[model samples]
Target chain A: MIRGWLSSRTDLPLKGDAASRFLPWVVAVMVYLAVLALAGALLARDSVLRWSRSLTGTLTVQIAVPAGERNLDVAMADRIDRTLELLRRTPGIDRAQALSADQISALLEPWLGGGAIVDELPLPALIDVALVPGARVDLKALAERLAAAVPGAALDDHGKWLKDLIRLALAAQAAAGLILLLVTGCAVAAVVFAVRTSLAIHRDVVEILHLVGARDRYIASQFQRHALALSLKGGLSGWLLALITLGGAAWALLSLDAALMPRPSLAWLEWLLILLPPFAATGIAVLTARLAVHNVLGRMI
Target chain B: MSYAGGPEIVSDLTFQLAAGSFHFLTGPSGAGKSSLLKILYLALRPSRGIVELFGRDVRTLGRADLPALRRRIGVVFQDFRLIPHLSALDNVALPLRIAGAKEAQVREHVSELLRWVGLGEQMNALPATLSGGQQQRISIARAVIGRPALLLADEPTGNVDDAIAVRLLYLFEELNKMGTTVLIASHNESLVQRFPHARLHLEGGRLERRTA
Candidate 1:
């Protein structure tokens, strides 16, 4: 059975049918594009959420007391020293530091610009913490403790920015998934139609086989093998071409001025999603050919 | 061969040609002579007749079981039905190849038969390149290549001159003498008269035996 179907493919001029060849190319390209779109949603959104949440991983402390404000400056500095001491004793604290005046301004320089204002603009003291790698810090408990030691102290976890970023990333990924489904459906329909057209054109061959008493399976197997080969070839080639195009787009995105605009870095693990298109194409093509062949044979005989 | 269409083309036809027997079907055009020959060769079903060949009913045979029967009974159409794409040799070898006989064995048998039919010099020539007599000879070679149990020829000599037609009939007679049942359907009165054989006559889809 396998041999006869194979011989039919090689002996018959099925590839001579233009639709047979062209359809695979279309399926390959569409699937590749769909995969890249899906990958874009996965990698970009994941990176965005990760970067946004990384911005605030520490707590700060300060003291407010009655006296001349400059006299209380010593007390505030003393309170900051105690807070850092206490944070070091905490279980998950990797390291914590109270930022000096200049260190605080350097952090705001890109946003505020250089040497544009006189001294003494009121700014909250900031503490930078480098968490233990792969560790989770308790922000609520740390905030309460810092408020008690330094009455004016407050903890910043960068929650609002992270929440919005995660939401937007999730929404984009959802949209990409919807597009992939639509493209896959379209590819299946195209391949099915192509197979049907080729079968119709080769009606005489089918008639000859019919009169000669060839089983339906014997006829359908010929189309199945041909359709599968063309589809996979087109699919793999299209994926390579789509990746080349996508890599160029990624390069363009990366070349933007980082000081003016920040974008998520393209990561390796998430590109795994890029493979969906070719596999989808192979499945659709085989299914489409099988169904198309059976349908045509039914109508023809 | 039993067909169930509204009108009968061949009715109550019952006869058999023993192995090595040769028969001639003679009647005017449209007298169902071709129709009767068609049934004999498994081409058309008889409206109301039992055609038992090789101990099996033609009408009861499934399509899957028909090819071997067809291969055993070589059919030469009145128009010389040769596949135009194939060379004369290939056309003759089609039956052997389709039956999955050993390739080497088929080549030997086809080449020898093609030589016997005087197409040895026309081996490489396609059907379209052959003269009518040459093409008809190739058709005969194809029919007899398998050494079929039964051979059916319709107007086997109609398209050729007397000399070529005589040569073709001699080939049929040789095959018949070698143990192949032969049935030749011809409207040519002189040709049938020249080649002596048992005659089966049909008129208005009815058969009559002429003992003489």
Candidate 2:
């Protein structure tokens, strides 16, 4: 009984929607931008985390054979086998696999062009290494051992390159965050303007309500409800637009499959994050409308 | 009561009506009859006087407390301030809605009051479609819908015919007899003279009381 009475008590007429058509579209655009930025940030951060985790305990050993050797093929084969044997004997090294000539040529195909020149070039013999989880490898000591066994042998732990990659990803994520903040601010400003205009249009209604003993909260709640509805409408539209755009991009990326950039994919948790922008936009609209109404009512009798 | 840095609109106003009493406020233009009524209904805060309404000092009342106090009183503006977008029934149900009354009770009471004010057929009509007299009755029905403890009307019968005016006065008398204090500010002294109620005469922002 009480709930029914309270719910039916005060409902402002939804007529006289002076800015309804324009305000929701503006909010939709803002939310779209916000969702895109949030998605970008989430994807960038996730990619960085996955890349770091996969690359954390790995090394690549490269042994170069001199270009003008008397028997370069035999010398290269001997150095590659010796390096593999040494890596297998090492304590922290879990697995080591030496790259075949064809494999090396394939790796360079994208960069140096796939032709006979890639075979003729005296490219260094590459050995892929994997370290046991939680096992610390002394790369300097390992490098010395490999160098003693074979001249021109180099061990790369990839720590410096990994640091730079992670840094770049973090910077991109931060830029996306800044964009999200800007979009949220724009949404708030739009809501405030819409609310202020609505209040101005309904100024006489407010005065009559006040004269009839309506409390400030009662009056403000009407504006809040209206603003919330607009925000929800706009927010959902923007979210759907964002989802369509993302789906299209993912499809395009799948079709292109490792052509240039990395294939785009989002984890389940990351996909859930796409829902935040609309709800946040709605919340911002409600709060902004309430504050705006309270500010105007404060100045009135 | 006055605006800041301006001359007092109403001053030396020192009279109290007994509960359930009815009084007519008579004054010429610019005499501040409406101003006094505004203060009485808590619409305007007086600059340099204590206002006691319903046995509480309104001077020290907080903003949060104003709505509750206001719910106990009702005001009919000189201009019928019915919401133009709302129907007559909705306008009349406004106070009950504001008080958070049950919808069924609000509908029943507002419907009954609108009928009593001779607006049964026009209950669903917007204020803009109604004649000025109909709007005036709508405003009056809104004011008395909640059965307020005090009722204030400013030139309420200004737009109505003499017969309707008499009927409206009888309605006010009935509400007064039911224990609601009534104060009406008007320039219609002849019409007011037809009733046997006390009168508060204002001249140049000063007040004089004349009792029956």
lDDT of 1 by residue, B11-111 (tens): 77667787888989888887877777777776666655577888898878765566667767877877777766568887777667666678799888988
DockQ values of all predictions: 0.17, 0.74
Considering every candidate listed, which one attains the maximal lDDT? 2
Q: Model 1 chain A, poorest ten-residue lDDT window? A: A3-12
TM-score of each: 0.66, 0.95
Q: What does fnat come to for each candidate?
A: 0.07, 0.71
- What is the per-residue lDDT of model 2 for residues A1-301, given as tens digits with 9 covering 90 to 100? 6345334423455435775557678778888888788777777777777777778888999997766789888988888888999999999889999988899998888778888999788789999999999998889999999989988899998888778878888888889888888888888888788778877877888889988999999999888777777788889999899889988877887786353355577778777778878888888888988998899888888
Chain B vs. true chain B: TM-score for each candidate?
A: 0.90, 0.98
Worst 10 residues of 2 chain B by lDDT: B4-13
